[model samples]
Target: METFADLVRALDTNTKTNAKVAALADYFRSASDSDKVWTIAILSHRRPPRPVNTRLLRQWAAELAGIQPWLFEESYHIVGDLAETIALIVPPDPQNETPLGTLSDYLNAFADLKQQSEAQKKAYVFKHWPGMTYYQRFVFTKLFTGGFRIGISQKLMTRALSQATGIDEEILAYRLMGTWDPTSVSFKALVLEPQLEEQYSKPYPFYLAYPLEEAPEKLGPPSQWVMEHKWDGIRAQLIFRKKTLFIWSRGEELVTEQYPEFQVLADVLPEGTVLDGELLPFPGGRVGSFKDLQKRLGRKKVSRRLLDETPVILRAYDVLEWEGADLRNKPFHYRNQILNTLLEQLHDSGQRYPLDGSPALEIANWESAALERERSREKHSEGLMLKRKDAPYRVGRKKGDWWKWKVDPFTIDAVLTYAMRGHGRRTNLFTDYTFALWDENKSGERELVTFAKAYSGLTDAELRQIDAWIKKNTLERFGPVRSVTPHHVFEIAFEGIAFSKRHKSGVATRFPRILRWRKDKSPEEANSLSDLKLLIP
Candidate 1:
């Protein structure tokens, strides 16, 4: 326990990746099996379930801190984060309690317990929580129950692991995707497994995300690029391990049951292989809109009709594993060769897994003259992605290896038709807006398509001015939204547009923002349904 406390002290002192990883690795290497299991449970239990009511939460907070509920509530507003606020007000007893440690230790410890029994684990955890306060318990609950999110990210964790183990970050990341029991098996056992052969060929494309600061021009000519439509879909890593299909989203949620269509791919694609690609809905032989995908996203079960209507397809861009070979360390060009070969083999096998070789489906090598000519014509494609053939797979945004060249946005003059009160900082202001496009066929009839609901992109003066207008010009009042007359014409800009049946205008916009206010344009001159249609893919 004292050793664990010392480890926490080391971790909290410097939040550097290397330090965190080393502290975690050392703790795991030294701690007993019982201590390692309990530590995992403690870390996993950091978040408690949200109370049914604020009154209950307030009471809990007050009791935990030995303060009145009213006083706690008053202080909560100033502190923002409730857990941190309570921790500050009622500091934990240093004599008996254990402080929070590095993330690497928690992760490694949890990884170790992958083979432990539930009853034994629960008993181990309960035996360790004596003399802890309710606030400490709250923190413990958060850590153990998988809600302990903080400033740390998985990328940072991977970086720390790389530094500690002297392994390549990319290799570590790929291995982390696999299931391993740290308690039963050593880290070396997890990494040194022989690569298995791929049974059926499948397209597993890797993506190259750009950094926030680097622009497209810095990467050189567009012809040297392999341009593909960057679809706004779920980033999925498809795995066919031990005869079962496992589809892991970017959020690390297991979504195999949600997308049953890919089960066929699981049966056909080679076993013991992992593929990374986008999971998108294709309805009526077309790529379904983002709005369409949103309908299926939240659903836990899919009806036969819904599944038939909105089928999903994996837009394979890169191959991570093939025939049990870890191709992630291989350069993009070499991996691409393996990917193309697999696609051809799958097509030749007459497989119905949507792994056919098609020009539109594959994004490799762009023509300079053709790209510029077709730039305006490609509606769904947000931009061109350029990747160096020999670049390794990196976790976060990396420069030089990849670049995204998006086309200029399509703007539309839309009228502000509705407003709603914003949350948090803009709680008092009517910042949420619903803009409308002109319905040319009907007189004074404008279809409200959610053009932009911006609580941002407005100056303080502009916000105040708009707030005043929203209060005055509100025609009718709903619970949270206020109907307004179509008087203000604002130029709305968006990166991509898609045809959506759910929306009023049968369309949805991505990343819409206020480019400028076109006060001079009348409601009659505002962009119409046809104009938005041209922007759809």
Candidate 2:
């Protein structure tokens, strides 16, 4: 227990990624098997269940430190963090306590006992309770369980591993996915071999994300670039390990049950393989709308109707794993060779894999110029991604490897027709404004095209001023939305303008947000029907 506390203290003081990784590696390498398991479990679980209506931990900390809660809250700004403030109040004392020296000692001790039986280790931990208080337990839980997620991130851990092991940070990142018990071969093995080839017998397509800084200014006009519509959907890694199928989202959530159809793909895919691609809704041989996918997310149980209506397809882009080999180190062109081979294999095996003629996939030769032309014609596409034929797989964002050339945002000046009371911090203000563009009639009279809405880009002072103006201008009132006189013109910016049969203007804006208020322009000076039509694609 003292050793665990010491580990926490050491970690608290060490902020550098390398130092933290070294400390963790050392702790795991030396700690008792029981202690190591506990640590891993705590870190994996991260946070405890929210205790039923207990006083806020900060309030208790303030009481113990002889300060008011408000004062402590204010002081948080000085310390720049909450955990540090609590640590400052509970300084460790040296009253003949058995101080644990180095983290490596702890980890080595723990790793040494990996061969021990599980029952024996359990019994050992049960018998080894060093006196711990409720407050101490709280602090310990926060540290070990990762509930105390502050000043640290998984990226930092990856960096630490790189520093400790003398491996490239990118290599470490590609392999590490937080702490896990090596004894649990199923989970730990997956982390140790995150490359798609080692884990899966079949090949999967993945987008090779390019760093913004590394993207070339001119890839020989848009013609050299292979453009594809960057869809807003879940990035999933599908694995058929043994007979069980697992679907892992980029967020690391196992969503196999949520998407059982993909599991059926295991019947066609070779066993012990992983594939990477976007998991998107496909209905009636066409990619379903993003709004259609919203119904499937976060649902633990899939309704029969939803399963039938919104069947998903894997939009394969890159192959990661193939036939128990880790191809992450292989260049993109080599991986593509494996990917193409696997696709042919799957098709021959009567398995489902998106191909050139498949309704779910749009595969073609890499052509940046042609893609730009296609993107211009298709408003749903966000941009194009470029991957080097021979770049090794890397973790996190790196330059010169992957590139995403997004389409420029579409902007238009629109009249502020309505305002609504905002939620959360802006509950008192009507900050959410509905804006419209002018739709001219043949008789020279203009009507409003209610196409966009914006709720951002305004400062607190601006919000307050707008709120006051909204209140003063008498107009029809709805429950939360208030109709206001069309006096203010705002420059609304958005990505992807799609023709919507359901909307009054036959068009809808994607990601519409306020860029700025055009205070100098009158409603008449705002964008006309022709301007809105120009942005149709």
Candidate 3:
């Protein structure tokens, strides 16, 4: 536990990726195999099902600390974190020769806490509290509270592990993917063991694109690039391995069960075929708005009506694997040749469904391509994807080879109606704001109606100025939320808009951010709800 706590502290203090990787590598070297597995699980968002409730921890903490509950609550708010506040307030363990426990020991003991009675829990906490060091107590409290965010990502962990074990980072990444239970698998089997060639549903890391900042002419001839519409949908990989179909999101979540419509592709796509594409919601052969797909995102099970409403379409942009061979290292044109051939084979076999292959743009030059990019939104595309014809599909974000030339975002002036304090670092500041547009009811007058909530895109100085203004202009307070006088209007920029029945404004905007403070406009001068609805595609 002490070693784990020390590692956590070291990780938190370090900002550089290399330094953090070194610290993780060092911990992996000394820690027991079991402890290492648990650490991986915890950092990968697989924390043990919280054995203790938050209320119990707070009550027990305040009771043991000899402080009022109100005092503890105040401290918690000021600190902006529950776990850290309890760690700070609690008295240190007694000065004695009590040896600390191992990481596995702590995990095992916490599971026992669930079965114990309230009095037994208090007794157990008291017994354990006095034996642990300060760092151990802090980590223990974090376990009790349920979130141990220490600035480490799963990607970073895999990179560090690759360094420690002399394994290829890509192989290590694939091994660590999916829902692997740490408690069931040993560290050696999970990491060091040789994997089966046909692991079946394993996904290759996604190749990402950087936004094109310069003029398109700088890239030379248009013939050098394979241009395709970047559809506004979920980035997914369709895998047909071992005579089965598996759909994985860009985040590596297995979403095969959620969208059952894609299962038919198993019969069409041959074995050992893998496609990197966008999972678009297309109804009546036309692209559905992003708002239509949000209804099915986190559902454990999708309904029949939803399947009919938003039929899933796989827009195959790139093919990573074909005919049981890894074609990621091949040039873009070669891969597309195979991809087009596969699509044609499926079509002629009478097994073709809604899966569509992307075609290269017919633009003659960079200037013409730019004009085509401007028409992206009209065609329900987020942007234009310009991939080098000779480039290979590499892992993660690499510069120069691929670029997403997205259209300018839709912007509108909206008044700030409500303000709320942000979490973590900006907890003391009113950084989050709910903006609204004037909506005319059956009557002649227009009323302010909530539209979008934006927390980012404002500079530090602008945020502080707004925070001060929010404090002075607050009209009413509802707990953490405050109704501010709607005098300030800000230009809100968004990617797309869609009609929504859930929102009061009857429209929802995607990725709304503060473009700039529109001090020139009043609340009355801001765009109306009807105007916002007009932008819905």
Candidate 4:
């Protein structure tokens, strides 16, 4: 636990990627194999169900620390993190021995708390908190709360592990994908062992593209890039190997049973065939909006009505593996050609594969490509994906080879209606804001109706200024949130808009953020709800 805590502190303090990788590599080489496995599990968001809830932890902590509950709550708000708050309040015992528990040891013990009584849980926490130092307590509390997020990226972690174990990073990344119980799988078998049959079900690390901020001409000639519509749907991998089908999301979740519509592909696609594509709700021979796809997401079991209503098709863009051969090392154009040919052959053979090849747009040059990108929203696509024709499909995000040239976001002028304190470093500042559009009630009077909440896109200076204004202009307090006087107007930018019954404004906007402070406009000049509804495609 101490070693793991030190590693966490080191990772938090280091800003450079190489330094972080070096620190993690050292820990990977020195820590026990079991601890290393647990570290990987925690880093990859595979932590076990939280053994204790925040409310219970707060109560127990306040009682044990000899502080009033109000004081503890106030301290928690100031600290902005529950783990750090508890760590600070709890004093260490002088007579206690140093904790020698490994990361696995503590995690396993916490997992056992699921069956224990409340008194037993309190006794267990009380027994351990005093003995540990602040750093150990912080890590322990984070694991207990299941909020153990750090500054480590999966790529960096994989790189560090590769450095420590002398394994290929790409191979290590692929091995780390898919669901595996950390408690049951040893580090040797999980990372160091020879590839097992389980590799058949594992999905490769997804290749992500950086957003194209520059003009399309900056990427050179259109002939050098393969242009495909950037479909606003789930990026996924379809794998058929060893007579079984697996569908993995870009987040590495194995969602094989979620969408059984693609099960027929397993029977038709040759063994060991793998495809990288978008799982789009392509009903009525057209790609549906993201809202349509959301209807079937996260279902443990898909119903017949859902299958009929929001049918999905894997719009394959690239083939990673074909007939047991790894095709990722092949040039993308070659791989895409093979994929198109395979799909065409499958269709001509009367195999009803619910799959479609992503069609490349016919653009003569950069100007034509830019014109095509402008029509992305018309096709319900976010933008165009430009991939180098000769580039290999590399693991993780790499620049210069692939880029997503997205259409400009929908922008609207709106009024700030509410403010809330942010977490982490901005805990003292009202950095989060809820913007609203003008709406008319039955009485025919205009009122600012809350529409979207934005936490980013404001500079530090602007954030502090707004925080001060919010403090002076607060109308009412609703716990941590404050209803602020709607004197400020700002331009809100979003990716898409959809009519929603769940929201008070009868609308929801995707990825809303502050574009800029529209101080020149009055509150009454802000856009209205009716105008917002016009954006719903």
Highest lDDT: give the candidate number. Answer: 4
> Candidate 1 at 288: error in angstroms?
3.2
What tens digits encode model 3's per-residue C-alpha lDDT throughout 233-303? 99999998888888889976677788888888876777889999998888887878887777778677888
Model 2: how large is the Cα RMSD against the reference?
11.1
- What residue runs in model 3 are displaced by over 4 Å at the alpha carbon? 51-71, 93-101, 108-134, 197-205, 241-248, 252-263, 283-285, 295-311, 324-331, 352-354, 365-368, 390-395, 423-425, 440-445, 501-504
Q: How much is the lDDT of residue 445 in candidate 3? A: 80
Question: Taking the tens digit of each residue's C-alpha lDDT, what string does model 1 give over 1-537?
Answer: 455555555665666767677776677567655455444433323222321233444455476568877678656554444544555555445464454444334444544544576555444344333334544444543344444554445555556545555666555445554333444454444543422422222223335577324544455654444544555578787877667777777755456678888777766777567777777778876666666677678577899999888888776667687767777888877777766777787777875574432122223334452364256334344454566666776665667776655566778888888987765467667777888875544566556555455445667688778889998998997745798888888888886677666677777777888888786888777887777787676
lDDT of 4 by residue, 479-509 (tens): 5789989899999999998888999999999
The list of candidate 2 runs beyond 4 A from truth reads 1-229, 348-380, 419-431, 437-451, 458-484, 497-508, 525-537
Better of 1 and 3 by TM-score: 3
Instruction: Tell me model 2's lDDT, rounded to 2 decimals.
Output: 0.60
Ranking by TM-score: 4, 3, 1, 2
Better of 1 and 3 by lDDT: 3
The alpha-carbon lDDT assigned to residue 60 of candidate 2 equals 56
Q: Rank the candidates by lDDT, best first.
A: 4, 3, 1, 2
RMSD per model, one decimal: 8.8, 11.1, 3.5, 3.3
For each candidate, the alpha-carbon lDDT, in order, equals 0.61, 0.60, 0.84, 0.89
- Give the TM-score of each candidate: 0.60, 0.55, 0.86, 0.87
